[model samples]
Structure formats: structure tokens, C-alpha cells
Target: MELIGQGMEGAVYDLGDGRVRKIWFDRRPDDVRPLKAFLDELPPLPFRTPRIHEITADADGQAVSEEDLLTGTALQESGVAEEQALDAFVAVVEALRATVAGPASKALPVLNQPFWREDLSWGEALAALVRRRAAESRHHFRRDVPDFDNLLETLTTRLATIEPDRLSVVHGDICQPNLLMDGPRTAAVLDWGFYSTAGDNTFDAALAAGFFDMYGPDAQRLDNLLLDRFERLGHDRQRMYLYRAAYAITTATIYDADAGDGHYVWCVGNLNRLPR
Candidate 1:
């Protein structure tokens, strides 16, 4: 077996003959089963998404599954000019908006359950989740804020103010590594574990845009792209800030097994910058 990729939940390896095996490590395959189904329910995207073929246990006692292997260049390793990759990434987000167009938010499965937050309305539940995560890893993280609990209250209160009149599928993580591209086009959007049920589309946009600007290709170009898309979507700068903070905190806590990761530190620093 040739190792190709690894993430928080598991490691992926090539099983030969157009098949790839994913062996779960830290996270259980059963926990993310609903998440994968959520991805399949979305409307056809502009890129290929592999369908799961079989699920079984690896010899090491981890849940394993075989799925179709994508042939395109993983965008992170594409080695193209930054501008080319940046444009392709933004275009994919636009296509993703069209892809997840569907019926009522309440109709979706993993999205419909409201596990993202208690109410999952604007982002009150999301803010709470972040705060809970922050508390869980408080021992690990060096607190940057003077009053962390107050920030949580502020996050929840301000997040509740925005009522999304409409909901769209939110790809929980939309960045270069999750993309498989063929030239300037996104050939596939891989990694479906973080797919959301429904939320303000702009919230999704902000999270992706912030991610690109912070750690992805063409950060400078994406700054304007981020601002323009948010403005066009009628999501104010303040809303983007709120979402970014929540996202940062969430990422920080989730990755706290190692306090030395630069991205994890970046996430914590951004979460600290949020105001009460």
C-alpha cells in the first residue's frame, strides 16, 4: 500500500486498480458515516466525488473503506502559478453554490439534525460549539484573551443577530488541499467529512475565503475576492469577522493535540482578536 494522504480522522492509501483505501485512525468511520451521506445528497458538483464501494476493517483494527481514486492533480501539489490556482479555487466555490441548490434546510439529513449547534439558526449553536471546544482544550492552549468566557458570550449574541433568510450547503472545509484540479478548473472537491446541512451561504464563503487568504495559494488576490463576494452576497464585514472567529476557534480546539502547529496557532491568534 502506498500512502497518499492523512488527516485528523484517518489515513488514505492507494489500493491499486482505481481503488483507494481509507483506514480510520483517531476518528471512527461510523461517526462520519452520516457526513458522507450528506455529501452524496448535494446536487451534482462541477467536479468528481468518489462513491464509497465497500467498508470493512483493516488488519490494524481500524475501519477501512475502498472508494474511487481521483486522477486529477491535488491542488495543493499542483505546482502551478499561484494566480491560476487561486482563480480555480474561487470558481469552484461559485460552482459549489450552484451544486448544493436544493429544497428546504429542514429536509437535509446531517444538516437537518441541528448538531452543528443547538438551534443552528444563524450561528448561535456554532458559537456555543466553539466555546465548548475552547474550554475542552483550554489546558493545552495558551489563552490569548483576557476574558475568554466574555468573548464566547459576545460571539453567541452577535452571531444570533443575523437570521439567514435562505440556507445553502456549507462545505465545512474549502481550501486548496481539499481540491483536485485539472488546469484552471476544479476537477473534484474531495473530503466530505465536514459537509454542513445548511447555513448562510456567505458564512461558508467567509470561512473558505479566510482560509485561502490565510494559508492557501494567492492570498493577496483572495483578499479582494473574499471582500467582493461577501459584499455581493450582502454579508457585512462584521458578519465575516464573526464567522472567521468561530471558525478559528473551532479549528484551534480540534487541532490542539499539538500546540506547535503554525496553523493551529494562527487559528488561536485570530480567535483571540475577536472583541466582546
Candidate 2:
């Protein structure tokens, strides 16, 4: 076996049998159910995603799986044009929609989790992250903490008045690196670890925007285009934009701190650029 990739929870290896193995370590308990659900649901989709052959859990409860995925370059490395990239992105969204809309999309009785929809209030969601970050900060004793409380207060106050009646299943982390492309037009999304059953799709869109802004030039244009697309889908563009900005800030703060930087410079940088 040879190491192919690694992340916070697990490492993936090529097993030299047209298959790959993913072994989990130090993963959250909350992750097990969703990952199992995702794996069970994935093979039925009429798209090009990895096929899980088997699931093996050790006595310690780590996950190991043999799977097959198309071997190719990452989409970001391909440098596809914006239009093509957008089309691919749309395709991914549509595919996910179909999968979740299928009969099998019903919430698992064991998990008792509903499909991601408009049920979660923006304030509630933002507050959860803030609380988590606060706890994390105290545990780590890191200095230069970002003003998470103030940021959360502002976001909560703003979102309290807006009622969200629309919702959808979200690919919680839709950054470019998770996307694989065979060419400019066809692509596949990998890494379902962060997939959520209750999240604003706008949050996902904003995350994509943040990914672009972090890596490319004229990223604001791309962000605007994404927001425009959401608006056309009948979403509240302004509110979603604000929520997205808040989500970005919160994410930066949380991840930066977890990675040992108490001050979330990246998130603050994006937050400062939010339209007044």
C-alpha cells in the first residue's frame, strides 16, 4: 500500500488492485453514522463516484474501506475555464439533488436526522460555531482571539428578522480541491466527510467563493456570480450573502484556532470585504 492522501480524520492509500483503502483515526463519533449513510447511498447514484467494496471496522472502531475512483488530475490543477467550472458545479448540485430526492433519501430511523432543509435558523447555526470556538479557545489558551462573540451577536441580530423558508441538502465543504475533473466539462466531487443533513445551500456557495478568493484573482466576481445564481433560484440573495460571509468568518476562526492560530486572519479578511 502507498499513501495517496490524508486529512484530519483518516489517510487513503492505493492498494494496487484498482482499489483504494481509507483508514480512519481519531475521528469524531458523530461522523460514523453520516459516513455509513453516505457510503450506502453513494453506489446507487448514476454518476462517477467511488464504489465502496467493503467496510471494515477495527476493535477500536476505526473505519477501513476498499473503494474505486477514477484516477486523474484534480480539477483545480486542470485550470478549467470559469464557465465550464460553473457548469460542472451545477451538474454536481443536480446529481446531489437527485440522490437526496430519491426514495432512499429518507432520514435513517436509527440516525433520526432530517434532510438538510430550511429548518435551522441562521442565528442558531452561527451560535453553535461561536460556542464551539469559545470552548476551543479556553482549552488551547491561544492569544489574539478574534472577536467571535461580537461577530456572532451581529450575525444573530441580523438573521433573527429574516425568515428562511427554503432549504436543500448541502455539500458542506465544496472547495475546489474536493472536485475531480476528467476534462473541462465533466467532474466528480470527493470527500463526503463534511456533508451535512441540515445546512443552508448558500453557506456552501459562499464556501466555494471563499475557496476561489483564497486562491485566485478577481474572486469577488466569482462570488457575485454564485450569489446571482442562487438569487435566480429564488433564494434571498442579500440574506444568503450575509449568512455566507458570517459562515466564512466563523469557519476561518474555528479552523485557524484548531490549527493553532488563535486569530482568524483569513476569515477576518473575508468578513471585512462584505458589502455594507
Estimate the overall C-alpha local distance difference test score of candidate 1. Answer: 0.66
List runs of model 2 lying over 4 Å from the truth: 28-33, 42-46, 50-53, 58-61, 94-127, 134-150, 158-167, 258-263
Model 2 C-alpha lDDT versus the unseen true structure: 0.57
Per residue, candidate 1 scores C-alpha lDDT tens digits across 83-179 of 7876776666666565444443333333123345434564665655566666766665545555666776687777767777666666767777888
* Residues 2-114, model 2: lDDT tens digits: 99998876898998988888787864344455555555665344346655677778678777777885565676787798788766655565455443322222242111223
Clashing pairs in 1: 111-197
Candidate 1 vs. true structure, TM-score = 0.81
- How much is 109 displaced in model 1, in angstroms? 11
TM-score, candidate 2, is 0.73
Ten-residue segment with the worst summed lDDT in candidate 1? 104-113
